[model samples]
Every structure is written in C-alpha cells, then in structure tokens.
Target: MSQTRFGNQIKQATLTPFEKEVIDGCLLGDGTLTKSGKEYRLRIEHALKDREYVSWKFEKLKRLCISDVQYVSNHDSTRFGTVGHPEITVLRQKWYRPVKQVPEDLVLTPIMLAIWFMDDGTKHRDTVDISVHSFSEQSLHLLQKQVSLLGIKTTVNSDGKGKRLYILKKSYPSFKRLTKPYILKCMERKLP
Candidate 1:
C-alpha cells in the first residue's frame, strides 16, 4: 500500500523494466543520472519546444517523479527529475565513471535506439548522424561495434565539435526499419 497513493512518494522507488530502458536511452543522449551517496536520480531537460517530448517521457516514468515538469525561464527549457532510488544508483555507477561511457555489457534495443535518436540524431542528405561527441574514441568504436550487431553499419567522424556516428546511406533502410516502430510521432520529422 506504500506506493498506492497517486501522489505519494515511495521511500525507495523501484524502476520498472520499461523505465530502465528509458534511462539507458537517455544516458546515451543528454540525460544525467546523478549519484549522491547511495542514491541516484535521473534529470531530463529539453528545449521548451520539446515540451511534448519531455511530457511523454514524464508520463513514462511518473512513478519516480515527485513533481510535474518545470519550465526553466533562464534556459528556455522544460525539465523534470526523478526522486532518488537505489536501483538508479546501480545504473549510474555502471554508465558513468567520472565521465559517461558506453557500458561494456550494453545490448541495444529498438526502443532504446529510438529514444537516443530523438535525443541526438539528425538527418543528413543521405545519412543519419548520432552525436557521440562526449564519448572517447574507444567508446565510440565500441558503440559502432554494438550497432553493427544489428546488421546496420556506421562510421565515426570528427568535425569541429566532436565525434558522431554516421549511419551510412546504404544502411538507412535498415536503421529506419529497426527504429521506426519505437519512434515517437512528435519526432518523426527527424526521419527520412
């Protein structure tokens, strides 16, 4: 009964399998799961124009959130955060070691890739670019390898800012097919 109340907070919120999938996708993008002592909380922020997107995410993980999404006037962004949870702490520890890195044991799923695409993917003339600038060269290589396991091929390129994984033109069909099912309607504009 402890977690039954509509607005009541759980002492140690347990994440659902779907929620874990959400977190994994977010970690690959800009979302931060911060650790304090033994607890970790996920914070999601996006442009005010993306309020609907963040709201969608909020709805998916509402059980862990104590408050509704907030508008940050300074950044002109919408943001929300989850309450601390030990389950989240485990993920943070696995994905972050001083700085974010691709988890060695990661297994990408369609929904997870869709979330990541919505977060960082951009469509080019004949390719898709997923910004992985924050990751080291080694981490990016590992990510490329992981993506290949699904039969999609990609290459890492570096520009003025940093590295990004470019889904080759030939693989666009496969990429689209794999991620389209999980792509949110609001983010369909990003696809070719």
Candidate 2:
C-alpha cells in the first residue's frame, strides 16, 4: 500500500496548550517533520543516554501515536569500533507543518525555546549557538525574527556546512532568563 494512503488511517488532531508548548519547542530543535509522498509524520530520536528524557517525551506524545515508541540499538563498528549507544524513535503521522515556517495560530513560548535549546542549542564561551544549519537562509531569518520578537537578538552565520543562528552576547541575559525555568536538570548543560 502507498505510505500516504496507509498513513491516512491516523487522523490529525489539535494539540493542547501544554502539548503545543512542548512539541513546538521540540520541532524547533531536533524534532523533524517528514513526508513520504502525502504522509506527514513527526519524528523524534535521542541517544540511549537520554532514555529518560525521550521516555518523558514519549509519555507526552503517546496519545497521538499510532504505535508505541521503539527503542533501537545503534551500531557503527567500522566507525567507532563497537556497537554504539542506543536510541529511541517516537514517530506519529500528524498534520503539523515544519517549524521553519511556523503556523500563525501557534504561539511561541519560552518553554518551547528551552526545549529547542535542549535539542539543538549549545553553550559557547559567551554566546549560545542554535544549530539551525539544516535550515535554509530564509528559514533561519524567519527564526531570527521570531526570536527577536521575544526581545533577544540573533545573527546568522555560515560555517562550512550550513547556516547557524547565534544568540548574541547582548542577548545572553534575556535568553537565560527566558529558558532557565523550562530547562530540565539533566539538560542543565544547555543553559548559558
């Protein structure tokens, strides 16, 4: 059967406020919205060391999933000389679009920023780097604008790979104040 046709069995549902906050943050970070033909799915994966974190996310999203979250052991004997850490995937065929072009109706909150930082943000010496290299220049600009609306300033830079958004030094205090409360204890390292 076609993936789109098969996947259509799962209906799209509206997200609750809390769900929207968390999932939107996730999408801004490592969460991906993918399509196969006409099927759109949300995919989230994390290393086994983050089992608890992923499990926590699974719990928050399980109601919308067509199947249970699956745990898989990742192996790269050639590269790392041994089977590597485990990981988990929480996949669901939902109708949400990608975060690059955020929906107007969806609200962006500090909690979402915190979650996104947990996913793709790294603490630099005096600035925070949001790994948005996978996004296009236009998308990165949109993200910057969105963040700017929160009173934080961001600049886009291109490394060898792609473009990334840097939370400027001046924005450090605002960024820390906004995302601190939402950061989990395990993800404290992401904080500036």
Candidate 3:
C-alpha cells in the first residue's frame, strides 16, 4: 500500500516490539531524528558496501516507511566523512522528534544495545569501546550509569574526538552475554 493511505489502515499499525528496540539503538548511533516542515522522520544512512545490513534494517522497518529504501551515490559535496562507497538511506516513521538531550523514555534493552554496538561500538584488546563522543559529558555519564544498572561497569574518557565511553575488561563478559544473542551475523566481528 502507498503511504498516502494513512486513513485507518496506517493508524492501526504501530511500531512492533523489535522495531522499537531497533529505533532506540538507531537514535544512539548515526541515525538522526529530523523533521521536514511538520513531519518527523528517522533517517539512517550507511555505506553501500553495507547494503545488506541496510536492507536488513529496511525490511525490519518497511511498515513505517513512506517509500522503499533507496541506494543513492553520494558526490563530493554529499560525502559524510569518507568517500567512495555509495550510501543507502532508510527513512521511516513520522513521530520521532529530534531531542536536544538524552530522553528519559529510552529503556535500553539487550537488542538495542546490540544494534548500537554494531553501529558505533568497537572491540579493543582489553576493553570494549563505545563512541559516544557526539554526546555531552553529562549524557555520557548518565549512560554509563544506566549501563551500570545492568551490572556492566563503564567509564568515560576523552580523546581527540571528545568524550568516549568504554566497557571495562571485567565487564566484557556480562556485556557480551547481554548483547550477543541480538547481534546480527554480519556485525559479529564488532563483538569481543
């Protein structure tokens, strides 16, 4: 059905449980919640080489999208950070508003953690690195505490990129056990 059919059919359907967790993770990662005029959308863009991953996410979110996901080649002016790989865009939903700070409504779950890890977490020799430099120190600290509530200890550190968060080596096993089941096969390499 077309997105124009927003009468009763569309209103009847809301984000499924899995979709909710994925959106939570997307928000914590590179995905952006933005607006066009009055409508808000969740925008996710990834390199073309990761087309399969993008496609998988699209499949999971197709019900909320206005149109099919498209792979668009980015020119020099449009390159995000690096160039060469074409990018795919998966935009869906019209109710997600951009937040100035971390939202209290977010209930971080294991699946959400896995998605965020696949998106921005890095595996290091002795610790697990999570790139949260885009967030403020206060936000990072809050996140660290939130993770700690799950019994996983985390620390915030500063780098050239700003503030980054890390799951201590001692917490790696707990973190792994929490998020491993939800991680996608393609992103397995990101885990310890």
Candidate 4:
C-alpha cells in the first residue's frame, strides 16, 4: 500500500524548493513548528484583518492540508497549518532548540524575504523594520547578514531587551525591489 518510484520508496509529503522558501519566510514571523506525535507541522495565525494574507499562504500550502482556512470568532483571527510531516519535524529541530532560533546557515532568496516581510514587516515612513525582537543581537546579526546578500544594507538596533533589523531609508528602494512583487496586496500596508 506504500508508494515507490524507480524502485525507491517515496516518503510522505516532502516540501518543494519553493515551499521550503515559503516555510523559511513564515518561520521568520508568525509560523511555528509544532510536534504532532512523531512529526511536526507548520502553523500560522494572523489577525482577522490579515485573512487575505492567510488565504494567500493557504493557497500555496493547501496540498498539505485538509481543512480550509478557519475563522475563530473567539480570537477574531484566521489560521491554518499543514498536516504533520517528517520534513517539518526536521525543520523544527533546526529552528527551535528549546526556544526558537535562527539556524546557522540560513540562506535567503528574494521571495523568502517578501514572505518574511509580509508576516512581520512594519513600514515606518519611507523605511521598514523586520521585528525580530525575540532574537538576541548576535542572532539579528546573522539575519542582517543574510539580508545583505540581497544587496540591501540593514542595521541591527536594540531597545534594551531585543534587536530589530532596521532597513535604512536609502536601502528601501533595493529592499522594495526584491520583496514588492511577492508581497500580497492585502499586506501592502507594510510597504511605502
């Protein structure tokens, strides 16, 4: 009753390259990897106003899910998550060690950046900020370096407790160039 290809057994759902990027981006913000028995799943939640954004994610990931997007009136929020999979469990190991943390070799693409921005980015006038407050300065430095790979210069700023990756106004043009196309219209408020 199992599946095989070219005499090789095919495991349960594996993430496509694009889906991996989407997961990475989401993990940078609202996404969490939760253990479900032997596997782990990717879960996301957003305020009601961001339902369109959740729908966008669901459309990309529905192949892994059975439930439609849910509207929980009690919390007034929209939410969805993929079914448990071993691939997600592997990601959980890398992303969460007791507490969530960025992986050591986190490479990023433009679209991934867009996804991260949509989930957590805040527009401040002509500039933007990726609110990664749960991370330490060293971890923010790691992310700051990854964004630099896109040629957008960012500074890591701290507010006594945690750090934020501040994309400078001068670099907003470049940042916008990479993330604008993938940013959903529903999340356009995050852009200037």
lDDT of 2 by residue, 12-123 (tens): 4444678656767777777765553344445678776666667667677665554555666563111101001011112222213333544444455898888878888788
Q: Model 4: which residue pairs collide?
A: none
TM-score of each: 0.90, 0.71, 0.79, 0.90
Give each model's whole-structure lDDT: 0.84, 0.63, 0.64, 0.82
Pick by TM-score: 2 or 3, better one: 3
Give per-model CA RMSD.
2.6, 8.1, 6.7, 3.9
CA error at residue 32 for candidate 4, angstroms:
0.8
Residue 80 of model 4 has an lDDT of 93
Error in Å for residue 12 of model 2: 7.7
CA deviation > 4 Å runs, candidate 4:
1-11, 159-162
Off by over 4 Å in 2: 1-13, 34-39, 66-69, 75-107
lDDT of 1 by residue, 1-192 (tens): 333353234535567788889889988997998754457889999999889999998998888876899999999999998877777888888888868998888888777888898999988787688989899877887788888987789988886788788899999998999998878888877876
User: Can you list the residue pairs that collide in candidate 2?
Assistant: none
> Which ten contiguous residues of candidate 2 have the minimum total lDDT?
76-85
Greater-lDDT candidate between 1 and 2: 1
Candidate 3 segments whose C-alpha is farther than 4 A from its true place: 6-12, 75-99
Per-candidate total of colliding backbone pairs: 0, 0, 0, 0
